[model samples]
Each structure stands twice: as C-alpha cells, then as structure tokens.
Target: MISRIAETGHAVGTAVGYRNLSKKGQRTVKAGLLLSPVLLWLVLYKYLALGYNVYLSFSEMSYTGEFSFVGLANWQQLANDPVFFQSLFNTVVLFATIPVSIAIALGIAILLNQQFPGNNAFRSLFFLPYITMMVAIAVIWQYMFKTDGGVINYFLLQLGVIESNISWFGDSTWALVAIFAIQVWKTVGFYIVILLAGLQTIPEQVYQVAKIDGATRLQRFLYLTLPLLKSTIGVCMLVGIVISFRLFDLILVLTNGGPGNGTEILLTWIYKQAFLHGNFGYAAALSVVMIALAVVVALIGRNLQRSSHL
Candidate 1:
C-alpha cells in the first residue's frame, strides 16, 4: 500500500511540472508573436533602407537604374559641388528661427498660463495652425504673398512699408525671409503647446514661496522659471533644430529653391538632384551630409545646454 501511494505522488508531481513547462512555452511563443512584426518592420524598412542608401552613396546609380561602386567618386563630386555649400549655408541659416520661435512661443505660453478670460480659446486659436493641413496653409500664404493684389502687400502698401507690391517669392533677398516667416508661423504654435504644458507642470507652491519672499514677477521668472524650464527649452530647441534644418516643403511650395537657388535647403537640393537631375548617387551623398549635419547640431545643442546648466 505504501508503494502504491508513493507511485501516485510521483505521477502527480510529474504532471504538474509538465503543465508549468507548457504554460512557460506558451508565454514565450506569445511574446515572440507580438514582437515579430515590429522587429521585421524595423529591420526591413529602416535598417535596410539606411544600408542601401549608404551603398548607393558609394556607387554610381545611372538613369537606367544600374549601379556600380565607384569608390567615393560621389563623395568627391559632392565635395566640389557649389550648390552643396550654398544649401548647407542656407540650412544653417534656417536654424536661426529656432531660438526666435521658441522665445515667441515661451512668451505666448507665459501669457496663456495667466488667469484670463477666453484663455482656452486663445490657446486653441494659437494651436490651430499646427493641426491645419500644411498644403492649405502654404496655399493661403502663397496668395497672401502674391506680388499683385495680395493681402500682405496691400497692407504693406497701405502702411507705406514699401513703395509698391514686392514679389515675396520672386526676389532672392525676400524669398528666404518669406519662407523663414512661414516656417515660424507654422511651428510657433507647436512649441507654445509644449511650453504651456511644461509651465503647468510647475508647482504653484513654488510661486507661493517666491511671493512670500517678496520677489518681483520678473525676478521670480528670471531666478526660478527660466532655470526650471531649462530641460523643456532644451528639448524644444533640439526638435526645432531638426525640423528647421530639414525644411523642404515650404521652400518647395513657395520658391521651389528658385530665385537663383536663394532659398535652397539641403532636402530641396537633394530632391532636385535625385529627381530632376537624375543623380541618385550625388543625392545619396547629400543625404549623408544632411545626416552628419543633424548629428552635429544635436551634439552642439547638448553641449551648449550642459554648459548653460553648469
């Protein structure tokens, strides 16, 4: 009888262990199933494309879609291309609006943070541009910037700001500026939204303490708000750099990199080279340069932020 009881107990133990092992195997399979799609997408779409682009940059891609490795010939050509330097300079100059946009956004955020009538309405209005269609915005601005019978030029003429209607997109001096202004107009709202959210995260108690110490509003803002908002500002600045540096659509719609390439940016130049000029290898090299610029901008922003914090 004791032998029989021991045999039954061993059988129960073995069955329980097998059941647990089966459950573990099922969980492992489930996890793999969930992650497989995302891993496959990243590998094929992102990593594979990036590798192919690098390969193309080193090869001569012909109009017939044939390619052969030319051992840095594309890179050498890119180095000597005058348009590349002009586009790089324009790319750098476009970044000038980032600080201006952030500053304006921060100001608006501060104003919106105050207790006032129609505060939510104001916020929604400011953020409307960000949610609106980019193409629609561009079209509306294009009309407004028309050389004749345009609302903007009409107002300028009315105010004696200019002698006559000026072609905002035709002239080299104003073409880049017009694009810059449109970029700021479209993007300022996004930064404002980010900053407003950050501002709300600050504890009211901090302000209360400062008030108790009899600090003036400007003094409190300078001493506390700016310092505390550094992280948020840093994030906005980095993102703004990336967005403004890769500016293409606005220039495409407004100027098409025209007025003698006055408003040409890196991406637009790359588009022109790849599609119009049928120089895919050169475009790939330009893309590599763009990636390098982005990395350098990110690094420089980080270092500047660290130094400021220290």
Candidate 2:
C-alpha cells in the first residue's frame, strides 16, 4: 500500500510539470503572435530606414551627382557652418509661437467649455483652422502681411495706430515676428480643441463646490482649473514644442527662410545641406540634434507636471 501511494505521488508531479511547461510554451507563442506585426513594421521601416539615414549622414552626397564617404568630416564642417548657427537661432526664435497659440487655445477652450448657447458651434468653428491646408493658410497669410495694402496694415492705418504700413514680411528683422503671428493664428484653434478636451475631463462637481463656497471665477481658474489641467497642459505644450521645432512646410511656403536664412529653421537647413549643398551626412547629424532637442523638451514638460503637483 505504501509503494502504491509513492507511485501515485510521483505520477501527479510529472503530470503537473508537463502541464506547466505546455502552458509556458503556449504563452510564448501567443506573445510572439501578438508582437509579430509590430516587429515586422519596425524591421521594414523604422530600423532599416534609421540605419540607412545614419549611413547617409556620414558621407557626402550632393545633388551634383556625387557621393563619397567622409567619416565625421561632414559633422565637422557643419559645426563650423554659419548658416547652421543661424538656423539654430531661427529655430529657437520660432519656439515661442506655439506656446502663444496654446495660451490662446486655452482661453478659447475655456469659453467653449462653458454651458453657453451654441458651444458646439463655437468649438467646431475654432477647429476649422486645424483642418485647413497649410499651403492655403500660408498663402493667405502672406498676402495679409504684405508690405503695402495688406489688410492688417490697412486696418492699423485706418485706426491711426500707424501712419504707414509696416513691412510685415519684408524686412529681415521683423520677418520672424510676422511668421510667428501667422503661425499662432493658424494653430491657436488646434490647441483650443486639445485644451477643451482636457477641460471636459474635469468634473462639474468640483467647480460647483467651489462656486458654492464663494470662489470667484478667477480664483477657481487659478487654484482648481489650472491644477486639474496640469497633465493635459503638459501634453499640449510638449507636442507644441516638438511640432514647432519641426516646422518646415509653412516656413517654406511663407518665407522660404527668406531675407537671408533669417527664418530658416532646422528642417529647411537640413534640406539646404542635404539637397543644395550635397552634404547628406551633415544633414543627418542636424536631424539627430533636432530629435535630441525634442526629447529634451518632452522631458522638461514632464518635469513641469511633477513640480506643479508638488
């Protein structure tokens, strides 16, 4: 009887071990199946494309139909390039444009979040700019910023603010400011939608309670609304910073980095280096720098969120 009992115990252990192993294998298979598509896309696009770009960044490839390996030489040349510095300054100069847009968006979002009549209509109207073609916006904005007879200047003159039309898009000095104005106008609505969503997630009861306690609108906004919207604000700011750094199409359409590389940001600078100057490798290095800056901006935004909580 003792021998039979021992044999039964051994059989149970073996079966349990086999079952566990089978379950482990099944889980492994499932995980692989789930990740296969993502891995495939990574291999096909991100990994391979990134690898090629890195390789190209180390060489000299110009539109003049010449290609040569130059090691870190391109990076070295780019380091000493004046236009590169100008581009960096231009990129930084344009950074404020997006934040202003976000602020405007926040204001608009607050208005839309109110239980006023036609709230939906207001929200939709604000979002229209986001869907508008970048090229069209750029074109129309350029005409409005024209040196003479521009609508903005026309109104300013009529209002007696200025005796003459200011060269909005003409002078190199004021050109960046003009670009900022246009960028803000085109994107404020987009930010408003984002802020509106964030505002909606906040509970109505919180505001109601504040109101019940005699909190003024300004006080509630400062103490409760701003704190509650921290994460959303961070996300919007981070995205805005990243997008601002990468602004190319609109800049290209409006100023083409005009008046002498005054408005040329990183991407246009990259285009000039890679295509016009035939220095793909240097361009790649610049691209990496821009990417690193974006990552830094994201990190800063997260840090701000943490501090706001504290």
Candidate 3:
C-alpha cells in the first residue's frame, strides 16, 4: 500500500511540472509574436505622419524640390501677413455663431425627447443633413442665396420687399454673414443629434421625481438636465469649433474665399499660401499656428467641462 501511494504522488508531481512549463512556454511565444496590423498602423499612420509634418514645418521645401533652413520665417510672416490676419478674424466670426446654433440644437433635442408620434422620423430628418455630402450642401446653399434668380430673393421680390437683391457674397460684411448662416444650418442638426443622445440618457425616474416635487419644466432643465449634460455638450462644442476652424471643402466649393477675399478663413488662406503662392515654409508655419490653436481650443473646452461639472 505505501509503495502504490508513492508511485501516485510522483506521477501527480510530474503532471504539475509539465503544466507549469507549458504555460510559461505559451506566454513566451505570445510575447515574441510578430507585429500586428494595429501596431503597424500606430507606427506608420500616427507617429510617422506626425513626425514628418513637424519636421516639414521648420524647413523651406518649395514645389521646385529645393530645401533651405529658414528659422521662424513662416511664423514671422504670419504676423505681418494681412490675409492671415483677415482669416483669423473670419475664424472668430465663425465661432460666434456656435452659441446660437447650440441653443437651437438644445430646443430641438428637448422636443425630440418627448413621447410623440413620428419622433424617430423627426430625428432622422434632422440627422440626414449631417451625413449628406458637404459639397452638395454648399452648392445648393449658394444657389439658394444667389443675388439673382435665388428662391430666397425671389420670394422677397414677389412680396415687393426691396428694389435690389442682396449680394450675399459680394460685400465683405454680407459675405461673412452668408458663410456664418450656412455653417449654422449645416452644423445645428448634427449637434441636435448629439444633444438628443445626452437627453435620452437621463433617467425617467428623475423626471417623475422632479414632477412630484412641483418642479417646473424650466427648473428641471436648469437644475438637472443642463448640469448633467455638461460633458456631452462640451464634446459637441469642441467638434463644432474645430469644424469651423478647419472648414475647407465647403469653402472650396462655395465661395472659394472670393468676392475680393471677403469670405477668407484660415484654412482657405493656408491653401492659397501653400499651393497657389507656393510659399511652403510660410504655409507650414501657418499649419503649426492652426495646430496650436486647435490645442488651445481643446484645452479650454476640457477646462470648461470640468468647471461645469464642479
């Protein structure tokens, strides 16, 4: 009996040792595996692209394939460049419309949150514009806003409103207004969808409690909805601000910063500087400034989100 027991114990110990070695060997193999596509993407798409752009910003590389070391030339030119300053001013004007658009989006979100017929249909209708091609939207808007033969002007003309049609892209002041209006139209619906998601995440139980406590609609919105929606709304604002700053395709299709450059934005100006004028170094510097602005905007948005939560 003692001999049989000793033989069984030895067999069990051997099995345990084999199992331990197998696990370690498997782990070692896992650790030394070849690069996955995700790792390759991180190296090629992210790091390499970022490093190259940063390097290009400091060097003068014109279309002629010539390179020269120009330190601070582009950034220095950015300060004195009249059009760059104009573009910056245009960017500020563009951002001014964000609050108004967000306000409209909030109202839409609130309406969509209620239990009503065709609510999904209404939501889809609002969201459709966001997914539509920007080029198509820009073309259609420009036609609608045309100084003559435009549906908008035609309605006003039929009503005997004024002797002259408004030249939306003709004058500097009106040009910016036209761009701002288009931007708001394109962006508000997207933001509405975002706010709608945030609104729906809110608990029905909370609203029921608010009602039992004799809280008004406005009170609930102020005390509960708005406070709880800080994060979602902050993200939407960041997206809107970034889109406004980086607005390119729409500008390219619509006005092209034309009518004497009245509608020029920073990105449009950068395009002109880089491709049209072939000032690569200056354009790179402008690109750096834009990146810096983007960073600042992101930081400010995050800080505001934190403060709102507090």
Candidate 4:
C-alpha cells in the first residue's frame, strides 16, 4: 500500500511540472507574437532599404531605371568632384551654430528654471519656431532678408547700421550668414527645452547643500551643475551635429543653393545629383559618405560622454 501511494504522488508531481513548462512555453509564444510585427517592419523597411542603398552606391543607375554595376567608378568621381567638397565645407560651416545654440540655450534654460512670472509662457513662445512649418519659416525669412523693402534691411537702414540694403540671399557670403542666423534661431528653442528637462533632473537638495557649504553661484554652476549635466550636453551636441548635417529643406527653399552653390549642403547636392543630373550612383556614394561621417561623429560623441562619466 505504501509503495502504491508513493508512485501516485510522484506521477502527480511530474504532471504539475509538465503543466508549468507548458504555461511558460505559451507565454513565450505570446511574447514573440507581440514582437513579430515590429521585427518584420524593421526587416522589410529599414534593413532592406539600407542594404539596397549600399548596393546602389557601387552600381550605376540611368535615368531610365537601368542598373549596371560599375564598382568604384562613382566613388572615384566623387573623390575628384570639387562641388562635393564645396558642399561638405558648407555643411561643416553650419556646425558653428551648434556651440552658439548650446550656449544661448543653456543660459535661457537656467534663467527659466528659476521661479519667475510667466516662465512657462516664455518657454512655449521660444519653442514655437521649432514646431512651426519649415516652409512657412523659409517663406517668412526669405521675405524678411530681402535686400529691398525687407524688414531686416529696412530696420538696419533706419538705425544707420548699413549704408545700403545688404544682399542677404543675393550674396554668397551673406547668404550663408543668413542661413546660420535662421538655423540658430530655429534650433535654440529645442536646445533650451532639452536642457530645461536635464536641469530638472538635478536635485534641489544638492544645490541647497552646495549653498550651505559656501559655494558661490558661479562655482556651483561650473563644478556641480555642469559636471552633472555633462551627459545631457553630450546628447544635445550629438543631436545638433545630426541636425546640422541633415539641413536641406531650409537651404532648398530659402536659397535653392543659389548665388553659386554657396549654401548647398550634402543632402541638397545629393538631391540635385540624383534628380536633376540623374547621377544616381554618384549620389548614392555621396550619401554613403555622409552616413559614414555621421556614424563616426556619433561614436566619438558617445565615447566622450562615456569618458565624462568615468
């Protein structure tokens, strides 16, 4: 009787273990089912598109959609192209706005962090440019910067800042300057919002303790606040780099890369090559180079952030 009872108990224990395993297997199937759509989308859209672009960089594609593999010819042409280098240089020049934007945004964010009247309203006002349609911004700024009857030129003439109306979009040098100004104006609000979020993450108690320890405002800001916010600043710089590199619509609408390709950037150049000139392979090579540069910069930024934390 004791032997029989032990066998039955063992069978019951085995069945229970099997049921637990079956339930776990079902849960795993459910999880996989939930994730399958996202995985499929990435596979179809992101990875496949990226792979096709890479392949296209090595192959020549005619305006008639005929594809012929011509390895290294497009890349060789890109290396010898002066316009490519010019566009690259123009793109690099826009990077200057990143530091300026960061500095202005940091100051504004700090000021807004302090308790004051209408602080939220001010933030919303500043952020308006970021959300505003780029086409509208381009149209408005293009009109404002006009040499004749333009609001900016009109004001400058009235204030005796210039002897005559400046050719903002007409002159190459001044056109780049105008683009820089617009870029900074449009991006500063975004940086301010990001920095404000980072600032809030810092504890009030820490600031109070620093005060008790006789830390001056500047000292606390430099040593405590900056160090704590290093990660956030790194993130902003990375984002700024990407934004500066991807600049296309504003340049396209505002200047159309006119006055002699002065405001032309990598993207605009690529667009012209692919659509206007029908040099799709060369354009693909240019795109690949741009992607590589972006990846390298992002890696460097990540390393710097990691080092700062260390």
Among all candidates shown, the one with the greatest lDDT: 4
What lDDT does candidate 1 reach at residue 183? Answer: 82
User: Which prediction has more favorable lDDT, 1 or 3?
Assistant: 1
Q: Per-residue lDDT for 1-310 in model 3, tens only? A: 9999999999999778657777777676556565466778899997887676677777789678788887777677778888888887887678776767888899999989888999999988888877788889888988998898988788878899867898877787877887778788778888998898888888889989999999999999999989988888778778877667535888778788876787788788888988998887777777776777766767766765786652
Give the per-residue lDDT digits (tens) of candidate 4, residues 73-182.
Answer: 99999989988998888877887788789889999999999999999999999999988877789899999998889999999998999999899988888999999999
Poorest stretch of ten by lDDT in candidate 4: 301-310
Off by over 4 Å in 4: 1-33, 158-161, 304-310
Ranked candidates, highest TM-score first: 4, 2, 1, 3
- 240 in model 1: Cα distance from truth in Å? 2.8
Error of 4 at 194 (Å): 1.4
State TM-scores per candidate: 0.82, 0.83, 0.80, 0.85
Clashing pairs in 2: 57-281, 62-278
Q: For candidate 2, what's the RMSD?
A: 6.9
Instruction: Assess candidate 4 and give its TM-score to the true structure.
Output: 0.85
Off-target runs (Cα >4 Å) in candidate 1 are: 1-40, 300-310
Clashes of each: 0, 2, 0, 0
Q: Candidate 2: lDDT over CA atoms?
A: 0.80
Evaluated at residue 308, the lDDT of candidate 3 is 68
